[model samples]
Target chain A: MEQRRSFLKMIGLSVLGTIIGRAIIGREMLWLMLSKLTKVQAAEAPKQYGMVIDLRRCIGCHACSMACKLENNQPTGLVDGELETPNRRINWSIVLGREDGEQEKGKYPLLSKRFLPRTCMHCIDPPCTKVCPVDATYRRPEDGIVVVNYDRCIGCRYCMSACPYGARYFNWKKPDLGRPENPQVPVRPVGVVEKCTFCKHRIERGLEPACVETCLGRARIFGELSDPNSKVSKLIRERGAFRLLEDYDTKPSWYYLPW
Target chain B: MTNIEDVILNQLTKTTKRFYAFIGALLVMVAWGAFAWSIQLTRGLAVTGMNIPVYWGVYISNFVFLIGISHAGIAISAAVRLLRLELYRPLTRMAELLTIISLMLAAMNIVFDLGRPDRVLNMVFFADLSSPLVWDFISVSTYFILSTAYLFLGMREDLSRLADRLPGRRWLYKALSAGWSGSEQQRFGQERVLRWMAIIILPVMVSVHTTVAWIFGLQIAKPIWHESGLGPYFVTGAIVSGISMVTVIAWILRRLLGWGKFFTLEIFRGLGNFLRAVLLIYAYFMIAEQVTIRYGGESASLEVLEFYSTGAYAPYFWSFVILGTVIPFLILCIPRTRSIGGIVLASILVTVFMWVKRVIIIIPALMHPVLPPGIGMSTGIYAPTWVEWSILGGSYALGALLYTIFMKFFPIIDLEIGK
Candidate 1:
């Protein structure tokens, strides 16, 4: 009878404990949700760095992509002498040939082409940063640029799955730089994620990104979106630019001016 | 000695040639897997087949599948305890042991998948409250500890009974028994404790799989994986796969230990009925997930479905449907095929197919390529390398070796409780 009574008492205590525990966790979750809402609201201010791309001026050249490879010191091919596969290759910016998918009608020798140069949009509200377990990836408070600390990364690839744009790249093998390392850019080791930093190093030194500098058409524009006087702000306001996958509400810094 | 004690305790002393050979083969497989893992660690993830879009591959699938299989032991034990099902008492020990072993393997698979296994300690030092990976880490580890304690506590009575039989290990057994003299009060207290544990562990089991599902389901970026149904879907699938595993393992133990009296034909049929019901629910979840994806009119979802139906992963998807679910369901449903032998065969098929189903579930969704056509690669595929396959083989061998070694030391079937 005593044992049964103790068992019932224990059950009561456990039930109460679980309820109290759940209430605390529930309150914390509600607080987190509220804070996240406010954080999203705060992110809408125009104080962050951003970029604008003019598609009409992009002449289907691979200059930006080439410059990104050289600037970041990314591997050109795998160690086995074969060119890196498109899915596995680590490129900060990749140029997609318009001929692959954007073949429009009316092609009687008057063929026009348009290339889409893709890079990390540096989202103001980054899902990748939120999902990273170790805080290895985070959006900088000052600029809202999503950056990865390669040294702290455990290579779980959870961030890779969270990025909607497929912007993240995993270092599958030892990063075999085809050329000598650039002393300016920090060299990342193997077994970590890497992506475009919006030329944060150069930005700190008061210079434009390598891709923006080397663009043959001067199509890639980089500036502070927060400042109304900045060139990017004037371009976005005057030309009516649009961001990719606006439905996701990531608020990408990179905007496109349609042809 | 009583006939019950004789039958249960006799099997522990006999180490036959076949047992030695079986354990030897398992050791070889484990060695091969270790060698493969070393190569992976030394050469980076390049040794595996994983790439950018399909960043997660066979290792993650194995982790999910093994974890799913681990659920069977606890779910069964808890159900038996809660419902007062005397027929299942003999299975509790083996089931709990299976849970512990499989959970360890599941955790090991995560280590194998990591690009830098050395930095896993960072998860402990720098735990994030928001990340689902952290949730998974906490839930799985907690479940492991709780289940181990539960298993050990339940073993006290059996250990006490067998303490005097083995003179060399008597002290170990006595210590493990922990001063339980089998008085009325002790038995009463132990029963109460077991009952409470049964009540407690069921939700933990549910939470473990739900958190695992959240690791994928909460990712809004991945179309097929981002779904509300993932929690219940993973749990239901875990139960189905777990029951199938228990059925297969119980059958093997019945044959090996010659415990025909304890694990009768009726017990097998009872388990088969339970598996059939769980499989039906699992099939419903599959339909609900696919139908929701199809009706939602999301291009990414449609693209993933197309990949499963007619594209690269079509073969695996269809085989999972036919071999994993439909065939096993039919076998269990038919009266002629519901016998012990038929049930065992059906269970073997179900267990094997469940692993394949996990692979099918993981790969196609990943290969859908969410990146826009102008930016990233249009198509990506993953085929596991020999290193991955070898490691997979090694994990299975390790599981078998653990079970074999455990059987030698302890009583797999509790004669004191089960009549």
Candidate 2:
């Protein structure tokens, strides 16, 4: 009888301890969420924004690559070789990968490889922002554009790992310095993570991203798909294009079509 | 009395030499690994075998395996304390030690893969508090602390004994035990607190390994990793591999430290049953993952499934399935086949195979493209450079060295332990 009483007493104490610990953690989380709510309102722009990629005409020119580098100054190479290249630069925004459906240089040797000019898809259901413990990165409700607040970012790489798209990059070295410095993308510090923004700076200024503006072949498309009357909505409807990785349901803002 | 003094004097004299030699050996290997990492660090990631199609490789796989192995220590320690399983008494302290050492190394391996280890502190400062990785950091640390405390408490009465008797390091043990007073009331309090820690540690252990599975599973990149099954799979894998590690190490220690009477063939048989059950569970999950992917027939999922069953990963995959699962299960299931040496061999094999399976889980998914065809979203194939292997070697050596140092100071197989 005495042992039974003591066991019950122990259970009561443990339950009380756990509840107190949880209450403290819960309170801190609530405070963080509230502080984030009052700080910025990217939602003021519009909801349901997206992008469409024109697959056929992409010449792999890497102009989008240059624009991103000129803008953000991301690290030159993950691990650059000791030797030098003619450009002495590495491509961050531009990469050579097989088309989602094509094979090359074998029995069907003549089949052409397409240039994707890949960047962050900026999903409507952004997993990266959702998993950000510090509220350092968030999606603006007004336009549904995801953005990162660098000052608040603690380079834990949780965002880096959470991103399923492989879109995010870390500034392993110091952020690139001495770019012509378009204010579209901010240069990151060595420790914090970075990625291809949908150009929130350009969006705030009520303009398209510099890459969308500067596309020679005009392969990239950006606009508010929510406003069906918006140019992006019209183009998406007319051209029969789609967002990348739709099955995963990230609801990316970027779309591509093979021209 | 003179004979006892002579023995004590001899052990004391050997301490510094053994300590230096052990540390020197580990440091040399660490330096070698550091040099290799430097090469990979200096060269662009292009130096690796990775090209557009396969992104993750051996390094990431090893990371997952090591982290999984790290969990067994805590699991065993917690299980013993929670159920009051007296059979587990002899094993708990070593199990707790394994937990701390293995987990620290596992955490280090994750950081080692980062392009910038120098920026690691940012996770402490600027980490996304919401991300599972952040949760992983918190849970692993919590487990580390709890496991360490559980270890100390189990040995507290013993530490106090040493403090009272040993003159040279009376102060050290005194400090460690925190002036433990052995009133009957104190004994009761210690037991109560330990029971509490043991209960708390169970869910935390499950969360930590399952969170690792979530890291890849939640990612949309690899269809193989995207399944909900990964959590259960990882937790089971951790327990099985962890038990195997403890068994092998325990067997070895029994021979080396003259601790045969305590460890016993019966203890080995109990561990054998433990490994066999988990391995069968592991096999069931493996088949489930393959069947789901195969029957679903999504080209991407099929590709990963086919790759899992009979692709580039086939050799290692079969090796893992056979050596880690089938062979051990075969031996351990039959009582006649079960011997101390046989169980030890099986344990060692399971540990290595569990690591290989993790490598397969990590690398193959990166092999498949996530975006639409002709969109150029494919990852490149990557082979770990020599530097990665060196760091891995350094990590294992470091883990063993930590265990060695602890053994040198305290009698790990002391009669009162696990009691």
Candidate 3:
């Protein structure tokens, strides 16, 4: 035990010595990798892009869900490994809410619940992307979406717990599929996890997400928020929309409004 | 008296029938579980009752619980050994055994949550270095590897002594012994490695559990998962729960294998004291976790927190607190109550109760969905599919199988067996 302690001291001194030596040398590999790269001198930086979802226009029809399923070949109700109870179907499940105590006078109770279509919240501060040990899950570079590279996941389900909104799902069993499946959203295998991508497939092909196009209620809205004239931008400017679990500071792209 | 030469020759003997019978039972369970998993594969997550509202279910909870159970190895091998507590000498082997098997079991159990196990390697092929799950993979795999090597080195000297008696297995002993002649230098070198490993393993094992908690702690999910207490609290609960599992196994091994002569009452008394300490620490943390959650903005969490106190999953929750915490502490801490019988009972309770605790922690939070625009909270009640249950049963069988095989190849009680 005494010898081991001495060995630790020796290692510690060497590490300190190395650090001091590097400091005296001005710039080391550390400077190149840690400091200088982000200075924007030698490297060209692409846009840090994202999408905005307007909750006010969504109807509960699940056009986005069906589109994602057809596009991604997502089995009816499973993502990652978790199995869904029937009738609780989702990929992008929809929720409708109303303020309490609004009595339906006569023909009034037939109002459509305010549709809130949800999938991966795609938070600016993504906790789900940080906890995957094998790096099977990550935030994509071109876009700010935390996507699962199903082939690499060791099936630990660490990301499942990290997402506050229950956005991620695991492939607990082998995923079912039709042959020559949708080329865009690859049906994942059992033992990996998957989640919503804001219809990255359609977005990649220069098309609006199936959900955005399919919304008969026009409640589902998606677009680049950076282009101030975008429809999503126009709506957000007109009505103050908010994300879920705002206190966590996840800075989600999906937002809801009372209108 | 036998010569020193004769003493070293005894380990060659093959394992007896009792070992085979034990392993046979475990194999049957593994087979059943694998079959169930296959069924789950053909069908989808639809086989299980999990849904949008209650997304995670039994499988995720079991994964956490089993990892906690694996903490027994560090508590026994590192803690007791570091203190130079001689009572742990006879039991260290089994505890180490428990760690290796439990780690494997916990890793595999995650499959119950995977949509695609085939692509599990995507983590390696095109990986994301920034993910917490990635860190979890690296940490757990490291723990698994280090523990295995440590166990191997620790058992080397003993295996050397059992060589000649091993009959047809002299070469097996020779390889493990690295031709150890039990010289003072060899003992000193082995001891050096063991001590180093124990020192490093203590932190590694603790970190492993903490990382497991981080898998949930990092989540923005609910009050239960998103707490500062999630890390240390989980580590404490795991160690406490783990010791009891070790105690139960020790008791069973002593009785079934006629190991009583070496697994003495002194060891039992020492284990009792140690387990009591574990339980006390656990109780303190359990209370701290609950109190902190209750006081914090538990309601605002994406998942419900207070629901645990009165919702559908309440019994499993309270019972876990009682069984894993209250009862075990009360039994083990009392002076007159710290008997072998008391310890054994508490051990059994902690193991079973802590499992219930794991379920409550995982399911209730998951069940309390943060409803979306069109989605109403489906009354999230999930009864695990038959495949899920079978896989769980199979896991227990896998553990038992490994233990039995280990005993067959390596004698259950050695060195002090006949003394």
Highest lDDT scorer: 1
Give the TM-score, chain B only, in order for the candidates.
0.97, 0.90, 0.91
Write the residue-wise lDDT of candidate 1 on A111-181 in tens digits: 66666778898988787887788888988887888899888889999998888887888888777785788
Highest TM-score among the candidates is held by which one? 1
Across residues B189-266, which tens digit of lDDT does each residue of candidate 1 receive? 888788878888989999999999989988878778888889999999898888889888889988888788878899
lDDT of each: 0.85, 0.70, 0.69
Task: Please compute and give the TM-score of the first chain of candidate 2 against the native first chain.
Answer: 0.73
List candidate 1 segments past 4 Å from native. Answer: A1-46, A78-86, A97-99, A103-106, B373-378
Give me the overall lDDT of model 2: 0.70
Cα lDDT of model 2 by residue, A1-259, tens digit: 9669988998999899878866978977777755543322223445777777788767777787767666565544443434322122323466445543453433565566555567777777676785665667877777776777766665445565556566665443444454355554666654455676677777778888767777888877787778889877887788887766677677777777645
Question: DockQ of every model listed?
Answer: 0.53, 0.27, 0.40
Question: How close is every model to the real structure, measured as TM-score?
Answer: 0.94, 0.83, 0.84
Model 2 Cα lDDT, one tens digit per residue, B1-419: 34433332233335666468868898788778777667656653334344333434565677677777777776777787777777766777777788888888878776666545565676677756556666677877887788777788877776776676677888888888776888999999888888778888889888888878877776655666778888999988888888999998898778765467668888889889888888889899888877777777888778876776798779989999888788989889777789998898889999888888777777777666554322323343456656567778877887887888787666564335433
Better model by DockQ: candidate 2 vs candidate 3: 3
- Candidate 3, residue B17: lDDT: 74
Candidate 2 docks at the CAPRI level of acceptable
